[model samples]
Target: MSDKPYQDKAVIVTGASSGIGRALALRLADQGAWITLAARDAARLAVLAEECRQRGGKAIAVPTGVTGEAQCKALIERAVAEFGRLDVLINNAGIGATGLLEELPDLTLFKRVMDVNFYGVVYCTYYAVKHLKQTQGRIVNISSLGGKSPLPYNSNYNASKYAVHGFSDSVRMELAQAGVSVTLICPYWVVTEFHERLMDKDGTPRGPQGRAIYSEKTMTADQCAATTLKAAARRKREVLMGPGWLTVWLRIIAPGLVDKITIEMVLKPLVRRAEKTQSKE
Candidate 1:
């Protein structure tokens, strides 16, 4: 394997506006990759594309909302047209929601989460598979620990990730013979804007205290991105970061204990914080 695996390779990173996706794109830029930055925020993507160019990679900013199939198709088409071939597809676009399932005002919240987190992945992969097979390239699906172990008050988010988990695994099997590799990345609590963007029962962003509690724990986005790239380079089928594996193990060996910990240590703190924030409001 080359020291710079991404050198000259054409890679597409969804959710390139910020968080893990942004971090990963910058790192790939450092490796001299030809990068296609995809996200809804055109301004952010443009800025990131310039940064990638400064870091020694060729980059193009494509403002894309991955939830739509036509948009996803266009993203792939544009990347191939620019770079001539597709080497990697990072399905890093995702959204989050909080609140117990029953507390949610309507099931549309679930649909909204699923559309971005799950269907976005499906649509991108559907279009990218043929190109990936042509290059014997890779597909990296960004998932979460919640996908493996149910997290309290995050049913919508969990369900979407769970679907991603299943989809990635099934696609890996289907594409194995085609020389297309699928890697699923599950990370627990990375310090990202994800928490701040997490929606509440009414589809509004959750309070600051909820975001703060998560930032207090876990690794940074850069750390997660570095680990992710290493895993992708090795074509790892699945990689769990931070306390992700421990949480999954505990869930298997001591399901009840895991449940208690999730409720007491994780869920209750957020609930208390939310209540405290609401009291002041």
Candidate 2:
């Protein structure tokens, strides 16, 4: 669609059953890429694969739980076996939780968040690197704006994303010489099922706490997917999407000021509202 010539290329999209992952997979399919859709939801993956094929693209659904190393390895193996080569790997699968550090039980929530967000990216990158080195391909990691700027009540999520920024930057340096590119996509508050899945310390849903700060600025999954693919095509080191760009820049220019502002303007208010909502419920 971009006239950039992606026909017949092979791509692997993790968490491809829904949301941003699904949007990316379909976009690549439109570019005539052979897609390997990986997700834990086999049924949803199957439906997505069918949709891709219906659009006249080659696609296969591979059920994968990227939190496990073996599953990540199997996913790459299946992609290679099916497509013979891998051109791109989109590390998009992730989960989120909300609570204070003290509210969480030790590092359980932190570990779980990192396992899927950071470790899962690591596992997929490890396997994909071997193939990508051979093809001189690309890796696009779906990171959140939270990775660049800290967000209260979502410390675990922010930490995981920060780890991703560090990891991706290191890999990009290591792979630059090999002609294997790495791109990080940082998006802010896209309207997705992510909120519905957000959990508390007891694994209970964290429903709408208060009026969202960026409630009116929600970007669609398709818009995010398109921006991500464009970034990949350009081989950009980083792409910041949505209105969160200013916040990320502020963090770089004046960390303490932004930190104080974020705490005062966003975190405390949101926490109080959440507590009030929980009390009512």
Candidate 3:
């Protein structure tokens, strides 16, 4: 808990059923913030809400799929109705897409990724803005390092995060005048269920690439959550986790060098490992 406890402050955390959202929700609850846990998984959300309650904060579960405008609006309304007012909106709900764009047999995967990762944030923020402005609240966007630098073989995911970055940048300025802070959370690679949800063909998980991303070269959700909450409290314009701070600048300093390292560390290796897995399976 911070020195300045949230007490009765209301916070809504989308994707709170699991991963970083769950961790952040718990942290906020410990800081005495009233919490609304939102996700499509009702069972999981209920469990999380209970955990928040155990931490000594008021909490409710709102099972939500952020792709719909109506649902997003309802989520904000419910939070206000439950807690009397809204203080923060954390747009942490997102899906992942890995593997080469050309190899993806289902083109709809592109749209679905954008719908959840990009449009979900847009819908939730659009509805929550009124309450946020009313409270001089904060908008925390859980973006990715893909938003900052190139992520090879994951073009759709990259594009969606880049969209998120653009949207947050525009709104951060717009909301600044209103005293509602907008924060873009750019995490490099988080160990979470997101990669498992990255479907390839017919809802099958993208094989080795997803496995590699989750099991290797990733930061824990708790660490990411702690960083995110601190940033939100500080009303930071943007926060980049892990290697993002160095890597994003490195891209500007040495694009060609970065491209060469990316190919070696990411592109070729992922393709090779995925192909090898396919052969074995």
Candidate 4:
């Protein structure tokens, strides 16, 4: 391995408009990586591309919504065409919803979350796998701690990440023989725009004003990006970031106990607040 492992590498970062994806792009750029910035926001992607260039990495903005298979294929093709090869693919695009499954107005919330979070990863990886094989590259999936354990009011989000967890793990085994590495990143609550994108019970985006229970102990997007980059560089199989790993272990040793703890420590407060907010409305 080289001291500057990412130097001159061709990397594609989905959801590059903001949050963890944006942070990852900038950090990769600083490492001299050729970055392909993909997001729904063309304006933001273009701006980020320029910033990457200023940091010494070549970059291209490929405006994309990962929900469509054709778009994902095109994204992979564009990155390979521009950079001559694909060294890394980061599946960081995701969305979330907050509410009990029974509370949602329709199943659209579940479908939408699955489409963006699970299918988006599937589409991008399916397209990029062959290219990555040629370069013996890396695939990084950004998941959540909620994926590993049950969290009330996040059934849709949890299901999506759970799908990602299983898919990524299975794919990693399949790609092991080809020298292509897959890394699953399960990070705890991070200070990002995720809360803004979180949907409420009525199938509407929560926006910035949405009331979310956040822990004072949180990691910044930059911190998450740095940690993820390190894990990907090392070709780690899976990593659990922050204290959230406890739930994963406890779930294994004492599933019922963990469930009770989760309900008491996290779910009850959320349900209480949701009820209060509803009463006012």
Candidate 5:
């Protein structure tokens, strides 16, 4: 790519406390970008900020909840104040849960996930668009495999990601004339705290699905982050990485066949495990 684009640019990464977000922030910082780290966990954000600063780039922590438009705007404002202008905004703050839709004890978490995953993206983009237009900047949204293809146990997460995928695509078209690039990074099963945070209806950590998926093939957060930065530098409209990319085309070409494989490979085994656990209980 044409001589590293991040140097001396202002980039904001939500969910910067850990995982792909943190990896991206550090990677960008190493390239001399002034990094704004945004996340709900203030302490972890602070730690990451220091780490970024030590990496030979400027860094700051903005404790933000993307669910609120005001906070999202504030995040941009802080970035501009610190770095003079914003070049990239990564909408990556999100969370999810695991349970069958029929078994979920409360629907509130569904809304929570949507508010954070989809609406959070909308809020950040709504505020970032103006500055991006001026800088002719890029907006990258961290979507998921779930966005393109729904997963077995994560109905709420699938909906939220699908919304993100839809929203990012529509805006990418609208903002083209304005010279702002919108890129969506869709990956499957990276190593992250995502699974540990996902809860069952009973408030307990969910079962082995995440682990099972990882056991098959999981990308490291740093690897995903590097791919994202590389894609963003080229201003690619969309980047789909990992084995999950195959499933998307399979779903399009032979949906019934894909569904049958999903049933046998993923759904049935997980369902049997659940049944066994319930019987023991």
Candidate 6:
């Protein structure tokens, strides 16, 4: 068996307060890596850190908002100061906003979604790349299947993830000679508190109409996290999770065919139902 890549390494995970981030933190901690947990919720992060310690792994919680560059830099600095070296950076912090592009009132909602989902990854990567290059480390970006295949009523969310896929691909090519590997984890509908936290600029829930659909295909956060860690350790380029791979592959083979099926089978039904619900109200 190959040696565990996480052993004796210092790792950082953003969005570590809950969901996949929390699970990834605990998983890495269990593997004997020193973990730095970054998220906006201090209380939740503290609790997660304690749990990591209980699991016999070193963990430090640093409440962070990945939307800003300074905070992203601080997160990296704190991790390096605590562990003296950084080996992995997991850009897992993200948010989703849903609405028909025409229905969104202004550009504000779109910008906010892009800021967190796209710029957050950019900021974290900007800071983490230097340390990673030094260690010939790894970067695992938490993209989504939506990144590869567009979904209905979530145009903004899909755009951000698509950007992630492109950016990761480009960087992965550049980092190849440096011995640093970049991996993208594309997951489909994981069961997490993500929707609860998803919001528009005014802090209203983004997609109440689609909650039932989300619940149907959702995998547990732990399952996603475990798969992500395994892929990262193996230094794989891309790992697509969930039962949606068939659709994704179909899209790869025939974009127009997949688009027609999605629009006809999924989007039309959803739009019709939404219209009926509105008429009833």
Model 4 Cα displacement at 176 (Å)? 0.5
Q: Which sections of candidate 4 miss by over 4 Å?
A: 210-216
- What is the Cα-based lDDT of residue 258 in candidate 2? 85
User: What TM-score should be assigned to candidate 2?
Assistant: 0.94
lDDT digits (tens) for residues 1-281 of candidate 4: 66678999999999999999999999999999999999999999999999999999999999999999999999999999999999999999988888988877889879999999999999999999999999999999999997888688899999999999999989999999999999999998888888887888776777777425465667889999999999999999888988777878889999998888889988899899888988999
- Please write out the lDDT profile of model 3 over residues 1-281, one tens digit for every residue: 45644667899999999889998888888888899999999999998889899988889999999988899999999999999899999999988767687787878888888998999999999989989999999999999888999779878888999999999999988988899998999987788777766775445775545556565556889889988988888888888788878998999999999999999998898889778978999
Model 1 C-alpha lDDT per residue in residues 174-238, reported as the tens digit of each score: 99998889999999888888888888888998656546656455788999999999899999999
Q: Model 4: how far is 260 from its true place, Å?
A: 1.6
Tell me each candidate's RMSD, in Å, in order: 1.7, 2.0, 2.2, 1.4, 1.9, 2.3
Question: What value does the lDDT take at residue 243 in candidate 2?
Answer: 62
Off by over 4 Å in 1: 207-210, 214-217, 268-281
Model 5, runs deviating above 4 Å: 207-213
Candidates' lDDT values, in order? 0.92, 0.88, 0.87, 0.92, 0.88, 0.87
Query: Candidate 2 lDDT, tens digit per residue, 161-194?
Result: 9999999999999999899999999998786677
User: Which 10-residue span in candidate 1 carries the lowest summed lDDT?
Assistant: 208-217
Q: Model 6 clash pairs?
A: none
TM-score: model 1 vs. ground truth: 0.94
Ten residues in a row with the worst lDDT in model 2? 205-214
- Between prediction 1 and prediction 4, the one with superior TM-score is 4
Candidate 6 local lDDT, 215-271, one digit each (tens) = 554788888998998898889999877656787878889999878888899888867
How do the residues 1-281 of candidate 5 rate in per-residue lDDT, one tens digit apiece? 55667999899999999889999999998998899999999999998899888988899999999999999999999899888898999999888877778887778877888999999999999988888898999999999988987778788899999999999999999999988999999988888877767776554765556555466357889999999998888889888877666889889999998888888988888788878988999
